[model samples]
Target: MAQPTAATTTSDGYAEGRTDTETVSRTLATSESGLEVTVFDSIRSISAARWNEVVERSTCGSVFHRYEWLEAIEAGLGKTPRHLVVEKDGNLIGLLPNFVVDIEKTPFRRLSSSYPGFGGPLVTTDVAESLSLLAEAVPELCTGRTVVHQIRGLDTKYMRYNNYLQSEGYEPYRRECRFVLDLTQGYGEIYDGMSKTRRRGIDRGTDGDYEIVEEELTRPNLERFHRVYEQVMDRVDGDGYPLSFFERLLDMRERLLLLTIRIDGEYAGGFLELLDEQRSSIHGFFAAVPEDYFGDHASELLYDYVIRWGIDNGYDTYDFGSTNANFENGVFRFKEGFGGRILPILVWERGCSPLWKMLKAGRSLYWPHRYE
Candidate 1:
């Protein structure tokens, strides 16, 4: 639990020379408490087993923090990975899997976590101490660079981390909420606890001829899911990930579950869920339903099936993902019908350069809707 100062080394594993932005290289940083932080430019440099070990042991770890998820993201999104691994006494303790994104036609850059859902560092123990060490090393990681560093904490456990970041001059830019259904109770009890309207929707959907099936995460299945997802996103005017993202997600099919809904042999809706067998938790990653079936309660049916699947599989929790807390949109009301509690998801950010601050201020003025 000692506070450590950071020192950096070059990509060739040397202790001298500066980091080059164009190349994928390694940088080593050490702290005063015998703590060493290594920046790996490639996901392959860290063993999956070792990285997942820290994730499985940490409270904030999720599917997005896994090594395979980052690999797939890099493959699909073409983002540069700048993953940090923290060690103490030659033993692995923490990890922060992040990516570098270059804004098109702009000199500004963003150093953000793998995705917007849930990321930061997965620390086995001494979370605060580990974070302090990581925070100290962040400046070195951003040396000779001008980028905005944004980290999100999805779990309430991250509030402590948020406090630390705030003390270190980071700003809480956005607030989001996520819903989680506890599966430890009986399904009957869970169903009975749902709102009357939600219960009716579930019953109606279940009584219909809609067929629900779990499909393998293959290219064809992913493509079909993406098609439906795109339709829904278009209807809502939401931003969608490229098809290559779903394609890469299929690469880790062993850790993913694809649930598709069919009505009269026609694909109606579907969702992709991430499975954490060790934690007995399932996270709702992405979903899509056509506008034609908006009133048909296709989403309710999907959630019902997913919840029952979790129960059947002996999973302990069903995470419904995040929603903007600033507005109680239709999506938020829809998820609230289920018997899940709302938990805050905080995003901590810091401006690394004058240009980034000016750009951020300009964005606030030009795009006021973003902050709303």
Candidate 2:
């Protein structure tokens, strides 16, 4: 079993209390069994090769867990990272990509996973022990500073890890659903396997005058998509990231797929999906279209194009993003039509300080509509 040494502070100024000497000594220590865990203030400080190696070996790993993704978040969102790397016998074995959220004057100081997707620890088959050690180290890392420790992921694939967290006093909250389409069976079979209604929708969308064009991740193209995205968010009363977020994503063009739906050469709808070539999966991250185009099935055409692109590119699955399990709304219905299976995604959270209780009580008073 891996054992943790003394808790270390991050080199970045984000580590509020601890001094540099304390942090450096803690980082260099090892357990009796030669297991060591180090916390990094920035993803750039860690070896890309070593970090990605653990990601490649973990079953639940995704593009969101990649070093570049987290680096982008740091560069774009300005979130302070507290990335944990675990090693045994001098070999990297486990990783947890987390960030600290400490807004000025707000009583809430949270250490959480990256937004919009699965993020917890990605470990080897010896999941129980690796997670237990990491969990044990969390409290010390926070050191009475953070109010809450929150971990969110897209599926229950980490059932064992979740159970371990529960035993450690974490409350499992917000059960969401994710739709995934299996692409290993070949595109023809998968398309035929879809519900009759979905097939008809696709047929209509294909016959429509709209044309699907795969666009390069240019600033202008991203800006066009952002306009549609803003409109979609407005219609649904949803909050969105700044335009800079999409721009940062566009900067990492090699790892993305930007497909636009056009009606008579004018942009109508589109999706910005992430490509995980190593995992043979494509994640449908964000999509947008005018509310008037809902009936026109512009999204249907976009999805069809994305699925075909995945199949042609030899990907194994298409993740249609996440939805609330309690709400079977238009978004849920649209993704369900693809004949994808709905899986439960669990978010585990625990209040570590008294401020957390206060924050929960005054949640509406503080930020009423902000989706955490």
Candidate 3:
């Protein structure tokens, strides 16, 4: 994506050149002293230093809550940010990085702390009080044709705010869960821990004489992954993100990895992993194996390669990403083969009342809607 052309400041919406901070007045949040909450339309407006301070100190913080991540969402995907900031005695205490998402071909718009990733309220102090403030401001952001405000799951490590969110009218549920493997052990131990079936997958894919090569973020490789991604999404009745988003993410190389399995010097399959440096973890964001290569166990090879990479790189855990909560799903079983513990993807959502469900019934629903 090109640099966004500057737009003049406006009363009703955000401006490119000006950073406007809109303050919300609230005297009390459940009898606690008032904490001043404000809004920034563009993350570019805020000091990246100050914003990151909150993330670094906050218990619930992750890379998804960082300024750069939110900025990418705004610039790459064309989502308008409604980043909320919290303060008490002039000290930055909390932040919620939400973007406005419009559901196509429907009358639904919503505010998501993250639409394609994991993030929620990041609070450094007075956790419950800050959460309450964010909770109150969230509904108000869902104005106009907007019908919902969803906070995607926080990383499993810091997803303990269920009660806090539930207190503020956000319902917590799980339709997806991420499989996490401990990567601090030696490769021998890690390999032995895997299910016998998974061991066979590694053997089979290895026998196919494929190589797991780390691919550079070049146009051809990206286009190849994008095509594979689109096919995977199509099979699930889903929509994959545009190539531009991957380009932006690739720029943050310190926190991202792109790897592909090649057979006979040709790309056969690949996967994308997003690194959370602060937490010492790697997340499997995207993976695709063409139908022709399915028998080769490219998916298993990709996971094995990432596991080795994560362990060698000193990452504490390697995530297999989210899968349908159903026990019968192939994806679930595939990830489970790696011998990892299952944990719920902690998500808090509000809105999507009965009317919206009745309105959106069937028709191949995607996320947020699928959860509804």
Error of model 2, residue 340, in angstroms: 0.9
Give the number of colliding residue pairs in candidate 2: 0
Q: Which pairs clash inside model 2?
A: none
Which residue pairs clash in candidate 1? Answer: none
For residue 241, give model 3's deviation from the true position in Å. 0.8
Model 1: weakest 10-residue lDDT segment is 12-21
Q: What is the lDDT of residue 106 in candidate 1?
A: 68
- Local distance difference test, per candidate? 0.76, 0.75, 0.76
Put down candidate 1 lDDT per residue, 211-306, tens digits, no spaces.
889997788888989988888888888878889978887767898999998876778989889997766789897999887775677888999889
Q: In each prediction, how many residue pairs overlap at the backbone (N, C-alpha, C within less than 3 A)?
A: 0, 0, 0
Looking at candidate 1, what is the lDDT of residue 308? 91
Sort by TM-score, best first.
1, 3, 2
User: Per-residue CA lDDT of candidate 2, range 1-372, in tens?
Assistant: 222245444533243333323332135234566667777767776777888888888877878888878877876787777888778877889898888877346745678875645688888645666676678767755645677888887556666576678888787765467888998887798788787878887888777788888898899988988988998898888866668777777655898998988876677878989998767889898888787876677877888888988888889999998876644467778778888877767788878777777776776465443333
Residue 333: error of model 1 in Å?
1.4
Candidate 2 lDDT score at position 41: 69
